[model samples]
Target: MTTQENVRRVLDWAVAEIGVPGIVAEVKDGDQTWFASAGVADIRTGAARRPGEYLHTGSSGKAFTAAVLLSLEAEGRLSLEDTVNTRLPGVLGTNGYDGDKITIRHLLSNTGGLFPTGLAPEVSHRYATRSGILEHRFDTFTTEELLRIAVSQPPVGAPGDRFEYANGGFHLAGAIIEKITGNTYAEEVDRRVIQPLGLTHTRVRPLDDTGYPAPHPRAYSTLFLKDGADPSTVTPENWESLMEEPGQPPLDVTEFNTSLAWSAGNVVSTTGDMIHFVDSMVTGSLLPPAQHRQLWTTVSTEGSYWMPHARYGLGMFEFDKQATGGRTLRGVGGSLWGTWFLAVGTPDDQHTIAVHTNTEWKSWDLMFKLIEAEFGVAIGA
Candidate 1:
């Protein structure tokens, strides 16, 4: 079968067997491009998933946050070496973290020992359960509120101690942007990157915007959290077992306020825009020489709570030749209620793949298969 056919098969398999509500993906290979989707956008109406629809880019926006800050550094407006103490004054010291020791770069790279909100039961309760999301879907959180939750917990470790996914660290980044430029992170991103690159479908989701633009698929989540449930234990494999009732339909969670996500997520985009935008990121087409080098400067994720096989850059990650498929694909990924997105490509921009399912989370087998199909990457190669 053709590679496109194989990719389509995987998408179909994801929907039919893996229980994703819908899926859309696009592959950009130099002058040629391919797009396809499977399953239903609106399960009730059987509407089709399409390529141009807006997608929730969860933590994928973290990359853009880093890019904008790096742009500032390029202009000598700020330095990545600046400490949290240096930038924000008194934010990190209270939570057993020493702001004096933590650099802005540590926040971007998630090595700052910041508290991971997902590890909090309260946070997991609200975002990972049907009942909780239904009740709190319209909730709005200020930047301060997010930061408060972040530091409420003790530090995960000392600064630069190891890799741990810290969502709130990027919110601190947004604060730094505001402190330096007198502009919100979103505004800086729009003024500097999105408009300049002509990324038509990319928009920074504001805190108050609870709905997606037109052509968005209804996102669903199979979150059936039982009482006293440890949210950390809930994975795709053990999902059904945790449900109140077996074989329940995934809950629709398309509309959600993104205020809490802010700099970490809060970006809505299309697959085309994602690959285009990420292409600029990995290729360093938009950064100066020094900042670009800093952008890709690597950190080991071996001790990370997420993506341990990957090596993290400022806001991106790379699976080097020693990683699973022995080919380097550097990019960012994000997961939220009802959506999981991955926009990655070869370091040289030879092939870019953006894929997502309008369902909570999965094994990402389909994403990897799509990449291999598009690039003709043999297993273990």
Candidate 2:
């Protein structure tokens, strides 16, 4: 029952009220599919946003990663119960951690206790601010470098103790995928998920900075910079002040290397592909019955500093949107340097909505508003 008019209002509000530069959304309800956008894709050119524009979907790619690994389990190539040490011997037994104690299940469910090293204050100070992102934006990072950075930090919690978001866990998953299949994580994802679903617009973990496709909106970063201060440490009051100051346009962060995120957060895809991908997942077309159940098996994310009030599943989440008529929706969501994305579908596979903004900041409510508009649900907005 999603109409174009409803979507248009939400998109307009996002531009007029939230100032995303541009936003794109796709909603599918049974045989009816609706696509719309508001604001200009390029602030300078004033170009209109298009449905076909490519989106770097960030950790939303985790669903694809989980699907690939779970598909391998369905094929008897692996088991969710397998320990990390059993797969990749010595990669994770560092910094007050025991690799033998962590299971593939724990990693997928966001309970592996791996620290998100990319979010470290020092790392952010060097590469997350407006100017900091420039120095090494084009640098291609190897998996070894990524792992070394991640495990250098102490474990946040014991494996299976709590729901703590960890991007490094997915890298561990990617390493296991390569070890078991003798194929790159990207290759396995291609053969198992992308090729099967005919998702032509999706590519995971780009190899270089040159891979960012054209005909896409220029990404803008709201990570404000001032003197030598890191943007990651910006408090709410100061961030508000920075936003209210005039003549401050967001930085164009479109050209950075996606390999900095590797298999964890770097899947560039489109809304069209995402809507279809989530639909396929809900219909159990991606994994066998046993494996699909494993994928949907829930672990409470109560104390999670990331995505609170949701239940973590295998690389995805089930959100009980009290603001959206208390309906429970299943999907994967993620944010990158300059994007906030949410791709959700009804549990029965009757409807799906995929939406994302060009900037990572100032997107909290705008995202749920997109869904509220399409599904005619109430927003606490």
Candidate 3:
């Protein structure tokens, strides 16, 4: 099939098999570009997903956070080797691990040895104030809050012992940015990254309810009761309508308050903007060549089978080789609420493929297939 036909085929299969309510995809290689969308944005209002719609980039936000930190380092405001305690004292308290032993590098590499808190609580003391909550729009967070959460929990292992993915580290990084710049995390992000990139559609808005712009898709999730009750049997129409309620309780639906997971997962963007950000990073427009290289260096494995060479570097996931068929692609994946995103590309090829969906069920597989078909190479499961 021709490339256009191939793209269409992939879109059809995605909607049919994955129950993807909406998708915004962008494929680019050198001078070539292809954009497409399928299904309705709001199944309730019969609103179709349109080109240029924005979706929450999720953990993909980490790449931007890392870039901001690297930029600060370039300015000589801080160094990655600085210990957490030096910048934010009494924050990590002495109860759990030695906060002084955990360096900024540990946090960035996910080797800080901080234990997991499962998923963060949807509401917290950190965002108790209206101003604090709104600050999430620009990535506001405090180092003290983040370190307390990290050190209060028992160690997953000794520092640098092994890779244990933790959002606490990134949250700490966000706080460090605030301390060094004397600016809120959001302001620093805008000055250092978003505004520089001319990314108009992207913002850190966590409490805003303006919804996505025109042609936007309303996000949905499959709700299952925590009490072991049967999953909600609501139809798609009802699901679409229910999303209109703001400040809805977490128990009511699959949507999550990502503000609680700031720095690590609190980013929102579009496929187009994401591709632009990656292109800039790989081409050395964002960071110095050396710093960019540092960002790609891997620290730990994501899992054994799926990601053999998968390592967390800075705020990004680096896949050295695919666990499936080894068609090389490197980028990031993020999940929030019921949404999922995958952005993959190779340095030598300049070919980037990004996919964002409004639902989480089997979303990763759907993104992998689209990448494989577009790049003409098979990827593992």
Candidate 4:
């Protein structure tokens, strides 16, 4: 197939393999741009997905959170070395963890060693307010209550020992932002990044599925009524109605209510906005030169036995450099409520690609492969 045809086929395969209602992808290199969409936004209604439709970026939101925090540091409002207790007192104490011992750097780099609370479900239920979601609750507990839950749980490892990838660390980062800025985390994010970048389509508010914006794809999930049922028997379907299903609860699928993952991962955005933000960061426009260097420095590796070539930066991932066919792509991947997003690119060239889908399938890998072949460069793994 021709290069253009190869790109089209990769996108087509992604939509088909994931069983997504639709996908909107954007790619840019130098002065060139390419946009493509496949499948329906709402299969039942035959609606098509559009380029500007916002999707839940899941953990991919971490990059934005990290950027905001770095920007705050650059402004001399705070320091990465500041201990958590120095900013928010008596919060981490309930969890038996010393906030004073955990620095902002530790949180940003996922080296804090906090355990993941099974609180995503609980946070999803109690918090409807944007602030409330950033301050996720456990059994209706406030931010303080959730911190207590985290403290009560044993540490995954010693602070700053190694990377454990805890969402709680980011949540703490969000709380720190709130404590320092005296504003909602959403407000800080918007003022610092969203507004500055003019990302009109991106938002930190809860998604409204019923009255979803035009040309947006409906999310989907795989559900099984019986335990241990054949996984293959399950099928993907439009999850737009799932948000409103009575006796079914929306939090069941995503429990990111607390901003515990706030600085780690809680922002919602569009593919275009993500690519734009990434472009700005790599180009040293959003962050100071020194801090931006710290952001790209590898702090950990993400893959385990099942996936081998994934590495972790502050909040981003470094997939197989060789597999990407040699383009030094740096970005993040997030999954929430069966929705998935991947934003990636290189620094030297202006090349960047973002893929968003409603179903949480492995089809996103194809996006990197297509870009690799298109650019003919190896992204650092």
TM-score of each: 0.93, 0.91, 0.81, 0.78
Ranking by lDDT: 1, 2, 3, 4
lDDT of 3: 0.67
Residue-wise C-alpha lDDT for candidate 3, range 167-282, written one tens digit per residue: 77788888888888898888888898999999988877553333455555677664222222212322223433432233222221223355655677667788888888887775
| Regions of candidate 3 where Cα sits further than 4 Å from its true position | 120-147, 206-210, 223-226, 229-257, 302-309, 322-328, 361-363
lDDT score, candidate 1, position 50: 82
- What C-alpha lDDT do the candidate models reach, one value each? 0.82, 0.78, 0.67, 0.64
lDDT per residue for candidate 1 within 156-268, as digits (tens), equals 78888888888889989999999899987789999888998889999899878988989899988775676666676764357557655546777877777867788988899
Report RMSD for candidate 1.
2.5
Q: For candidate 3, what is the TM-score?
A: 0.81
Task: Give the clashing pairs for model 3.
Answer: 137-204, 138-186, 324-380
Which should have the higher TM-score, number 1 or number 2? 1
lDDT of 1 at 344: 83
lDDT of 4 by residue, 106-192 (tens): 887777767654333343333323234334433233456555545555676678887666677777777788888898877888998
| CA displacement after TM-score superposition, residue 272 of candidate 4 (Å) | 1.5
Candidate 2 backbone collisions, by pair:
none
lDDT of 2 by residue, 1-381 (tens): 436787888888888886678888888889988788888888999998898888888888888889999999998989999999999899886789898899999888889887765666545666645566778677777888777776777888899998888878887888889999998989989999999999998888557654467678888876555655555655423544433243467878887787766767688888989888988886677788999899888888776556645788898887656545677678878887677788888867469999878877474566566666766655443
Give Cα distance to truth, residue 196, candidate 3, Å: 1.8
TM-score of 1: 0.93
Candidate 2: residue 174 Cα off by (Å): 0.6
